[model samples]
Target: MPRTSEPWRKPPKAWKHEPGRPAPGRTHEQTDRRHPIGTRAHEGLRQASQGTRTLRTGPPHPMSTPFETLTALRDEWQALQPLSAENEARLWKKLRLWWNYHSNHIEGNTLTYGETELLLLHDRTTGNHSHREYLEMKAHDVGIEHARTLAADKSRLLTEGDIRDLNKIILKEPFWKAAETADGQPTRKEIIPGQYKTTPNNVRLPQGDIFFFASVEDTPPRMAELAAWMRRELDSPTLHPVAFAAKLHHDFVRIHPFDDGNGRVARLLVNYVLLRSGYLPLIVRTEDKANYLTALRLADAGEIGALVEYFQSLAAQSLEWGIKAARGESIEEPSDVEKEVQIFVRGQKSGDPGPPPRTPTQVRELILHGVEPFFRILDQKLATLSPLFAETGKPDIASVAQKIGLLLRSTAASPDYRWEKRFDFFGYTGKADAPFDFSTTIQVAFEPADYRICCDGNVLKSLRYDEMLTKEQSEHLAASILKAAFER
Candidate 1:
């Protein structure tokens, strides 16, 4: 019989080593199945693809709806951004491998945060993988590096060094090179040559370039002018820090100073500004790209309010997600809130009272008529629970309403209610409107129990009228309200 070597057989005692560490010359074999080099890049591409898919599809679900898949991937992306550099590197390695395995499959390739990060790191540094893998590895590396810096210090205070460090980390890798003409003017290449003579619209920079994007001669002068104006705007005491940062982000991107990577760099810069000014980082997921870009474009054309509103919404969404993730709650959505909102709004316009009003005034009326009695009951229950609001010397209605309004407004603006129109509606109208309508179809349109607070399409809080008011005092208040309404 021909001599046969068993490839599966271990090479005697010499090949084995300590159980924990890898063999001397060999790096640890990934139990996670990620490629060694293209890890981070793979994850970046996977996340980008997933985000695109989610926006195209609906929300997350068990059956792996495209939106669900994308949202899952995005959550992973957000989680990984704040890890230590070493941990991030390790995670990217595994993430890359995980991405590769799932690259061809729509159903089977799912990766958690840890797996995606490791794969991304492994695939990028090793360079042992295919070119496609290499590209993905590079992209993910850039993305994660940026994300890691964003998460470095959650207190939202950064020093000059921190800002410089961010700039270095984000701009260190060269993504693309500048093309110049005889007068030192930058040249834009047709990405598709004769078939497409126009500049690549959304091209990102490659690895290791002096600037994040290509800079034309005129671009610098224009940027200087814009920067000067921006400085003035930033110095204005009237501008809120959050609003300033959001506007700056839009203005910088509109300048498009670099040939590529303008959007990414501008966003990163915005995070730096926000963090330095005591605000959280904003991750504009690829799924939100359309709205994000549209808001920026609108601002570029002098629609500052729209952009500020968008940023405020984004900030609220991000914070709520951060809080939920911190609390270890599931961040995925089971229903398509965007679609639901659209449907609900359409119903209202079509004279359907099954859905609450869409406009702010209308929503206010609904809250006053349908939701305030419930809130009053809740207030009574809270007083009974803690003896705070029911204290004999408690302030009068104007004082109490003012106090309640202030408290609820602050909480309403938190991440929990920022993206949640329903909560916002209730919070704004419950205290502001007295003797609210409890009979109008629009007032009692949707059951309170049916509504939930969502952050980036994920539910963060849910409550029923009774759940918020469980005490005897609350029960009595509720009963009285109902009794009076019926009597009328």
Candidate 2:
């Protein structure tokens, strides 16, 4: 090798600049692809790529377009496809059972989740209910299977045939059933499966007027048009799947195409659209029936924004539940402890006005006191399950677990923790630091204005203005959060 006298050229030092300056890399123009050039920008990019940023970006805000909001939810759900596949069969069975119970219950099927699960999973039924309810539950499962089978083939479109089939499955070869007429006379009505109404069916309005749907002759064509619209929207890249599903649901109900089973089939088709489009099926909780109907009525009157928003919100909830389940995290919905505590506190305040309203400071102190017992109880529970955390062999984790238990319990108990606010108090506010991760904060509060309970920065529940929380509600919410922490 000829020894050229050229000095050894060193690899240019990684152009390190002074602190707080941009790193030596691409030019500003090049880095402007998205974020600005700096440590902060890099940190954001890192968090975004790893999805940590999304932890705070929950269901799309109401101000955003429904399509956009639902698309974000769908993206999150689609991202979990890998984890969902791990135990797809088992997860799906659970989801299907839940969907059946809620959907049917919303339409007056009258079966509990536990009962539905028992029947579907073990072919056994429990509790005291009409045999008709049991039959309806079984029939709903059939409808679910029909929808899922149809959904598996993406090329298939929502059709009059599909809707009729779903309705047939729901009604299960219907026969005459006892019913009531608008005249307050009890009677028996012919029940037909897979057919449009031959007689007039109407809903009573708040002002004592009957609202009729598409007439018997109009039902078939209206249904055909609805199916056509769904197909067109399904092909639209700009149309979010949840919106597509919701519109299908709304329009179907307005048509009242079937003599009966309109609501059940409408719900089934909604799930069909969702499942076909690679999203998790959702349940409009029976607990939320009033709101659900109100949303539908609004949608029927050319005001679909609220209904669309509602469905998108449900999709987001479904995404969260699926992700948690897939990740082996707790997927339980927190109970409404805020209402329970509010009722008790309100009763106390009304009966005895001796103690003045609580200051924020006093409110905070009482919440701590209420949770102290919870922490002690949780500690004993965790002790029995020590191996779960002890296996990590991180004393810090065990300690953090205890701290998290307190935070979870405190936040849950906050609503019921003796309130002493200044105004004719509507609700309470709570805050706690997550164990080990002091940077991570947890907050919960009741927003009386919206009748919503927000926990850990997410809206966990929506209650009626006068709703009261119960012990079962408070304990259920506390247990879910505590189990997640202890397992974590």
Candidate 3:
């Protein structure tokens, strides 16, 4: 017996193309168009009912929901704070200097650990600098002093035990406020008898009834589990030091074992990992807090691809800034490549017909079709540059041509493949002078689901179709085609 196809399913609602842009239904034209579609369909029935009229209304805007409001608040907070290159360079220098100084002090060169801790604690507690700034100041103070007294002291390198001890010492300070239960109960806030002398003040969460002891939680067991996972994943002998450091930083922050000061400790851990692996310590500035948080949040949500892309971008920016600082170049606002990518994505689907479908193949195809024009143009430019391959030390023209052929063949072989034309010239240089510089976009979609495909600023196709393919099959085929087309 032939298998019957399931009823066509609608796509999951796509994110509004532009950040902060209201949904399309709120637009006057959209509402008007929707009314006419329903009204025209029931015109015969209305005539039979003696020209009766019925107005249609939708549910109130979901933006008023508490979760939506909180999400908006988070977005606003992220937008209000941006990290700039100049601040990042300054912070990096400070951290390096402080690390050197502290290493020397710990090695009994001149300053003692107690004195270093006092300086850091005072600076941090008094708000002499922002939390990130204070870290930079303390690290640099230590690094500079270490260089002056023991430039060749290889023995001063910090061990794992030293890191643990440092964390303990830092937590012992009264900088972090502890959390309290939200029962409105009044109790003595002083240190209890036989309790550790280094207890911190307690505070309550904004919305929860739970309490948190500053930097003191039952985290050892969790930390051990996470560390075991890390050791297993990162034990490769040939891993690039920078990549390893980035991964470690991401994993540590995700665990978030510390009740307070996790950010500070995570930054230090990244530096320690990098330094131990022969890379310079990096200073992620407070000014870059929005971008940092965005990356971390995305990672926490299991978007590993997006997080890796963010890290690659951040690493590149840090390196470029470091080079500029070394050459005495003015450190101004760095170009935000991540922002550019986001803007490009938002612009591509700003006026989508509606939400996308749920089937994996449909979703994959929607994204692929949306980005197809950009890839097509990019491929064309690469083809034009094929003649300079030998000079550029890249693959030969024949190999590139062969790869393109394979991509075209694979795309043509797919039953779900569809092609559409789109105009996209945001970053194009030569085409600026051309009158009709529209590009060709190929949209490949699966049946059995409804998908909305848009490119540049226009909607191409919006329809409900059968879902004829699985997600894994779609991804495997799509990846092969794209790899052949673009990687060549």
Candidate 4:
């Protein structure tokens, strides 16, 4: 690593470090090594993590070095924080699209940036691609949301389990990919989501050298070490978060714990670190991949500065975008225009046939086919049981009068959208004789596009109605609800 990765100035008058004394906020109160965020690749550095270091707190000249530039932009953005509040909604939307595109793009997800944006921003899918591919993109978006949620929890520290959960979320479900054994015979590997690779996952270099990551057996401990180091480092203010995030990313890549999606997870972990540290989640554009990989290889050969600078540059790009957005400047780039043109041109070429604009009729059809049967089954069961309760069950199994209404929400050309209906069965059967002596409200409901069964105020079964919920599904759901009632 180059010295520039940790630029410092003389200690400021307002702060001082005593050799035997702990740094003001630095605690020796051992953070749970598994504090939910670490792998143990570098535990040796934990002791030295508390060493005294100076941070550059002064202003920087315009167009200076990466460190100075980052500091200056960070301060500038910080000052604009109040006014930038409005910009965040738009910026976050753009970022979610950007982060999803580049992260998956680097891993050969075939969705164009435009398709990704539409799929995410509009909940509409276009493009001629494999259903699995589209699902992967959506799943990746979900994985990002998961990471963001985890980062938002101030009580969370990184953990091996969290990282595994992230891998599971991004991959969603596992399938098989063709592979070869050491003997070079063709074979297939099953990728179980959330599980580490059972076999060695290595890559062949252009020059025929096999570049290997931590072995399958070595993965768990190393991941634990890395998580440990990350949580410990997070408490130290010495390393710029960009560098910390970059190093963590590199270490994760080296571990390559999972059977697949390691790169994507590493990128996500980078954002997790950044976001949790109050920094912007960056987009490592797919176009810069060659330079990015080279930086990683260079870091592998002991020149970590290249990697640090590379990530610093990316962090700078995100910061620059923020600074521009905060200043109310047009943050549009040529690529943004190109992406729009691409989507428009694609549609114009032969008319992009998207899913027929969602109709209320479709929503209604779901209710009729998917939801109505379940409600009917529940109602019939309640009526059947009414005689057992007799005088005790006061209401005697009255079903709600099937009130269907259009809610105040609309989307995708469906003005009379948002279909919802509820069927509730309420009764009081006391003295432990009728229906286990309980007063309860069980509702089979369809809110907007979701079909759910509720007991009291809790949802017992929920599903989104894109396709008709089959009779089998409805019957099974009703049976499950009745079975639960009998048990209680």
TM-score to native of every candidate shown: 0.34, 0.56, 0.34, 0.59
For model 1, the run of ten residues with the poorest summed lDDT: 419-428
lDDT of each: 0.38, 0.55, 0.38, 0.64
Q: In candidate 2, which residue pairs get closer than 3 Å at backbone N, Cα or C atoms, i.e. clash? A: 339-468, 339-469, 340-468, 340-469, 358-420
Best by lDDT: 4
Candidate 2 structure lDDT: 0.55
Candidate 1 ranges beyond 4 A from true positions: 1-118, 121-215, 225-238, 332-488
Which candidate has the top score in TM-score? 4
TM-score of 1: 0.34
At residue 231, candidate 2 shows an lDDT of 66
* Model 4 segments more than 4 A misplaced: 1-65, 83-86, 344-488
**Candidate 1, position 58, lDDT:** 19
Local accuracy of candidate 1 as per-residue lDDT tens digits, 1-488: 22212111112122234433544576543311121112222222233233431211112222122323323434454554564555444333333333232221111222322223334533312112344344433453464455446546544433333333433443344344455543446764422101111232333323433322224444454455545544443332224444456656665554455443444545656655555443445555432333555565455455454555565555555445444544445443322232234333433444323323133333343344334544555335334322211122211222323343444445543322221112111111323345232221111222222333222343322322212212332243344333322333
**Model 4 Cα lDDT, one tens digit per residue, 300-335:** 764455666677677778878887888888676655
TM-score of 4: 0.59
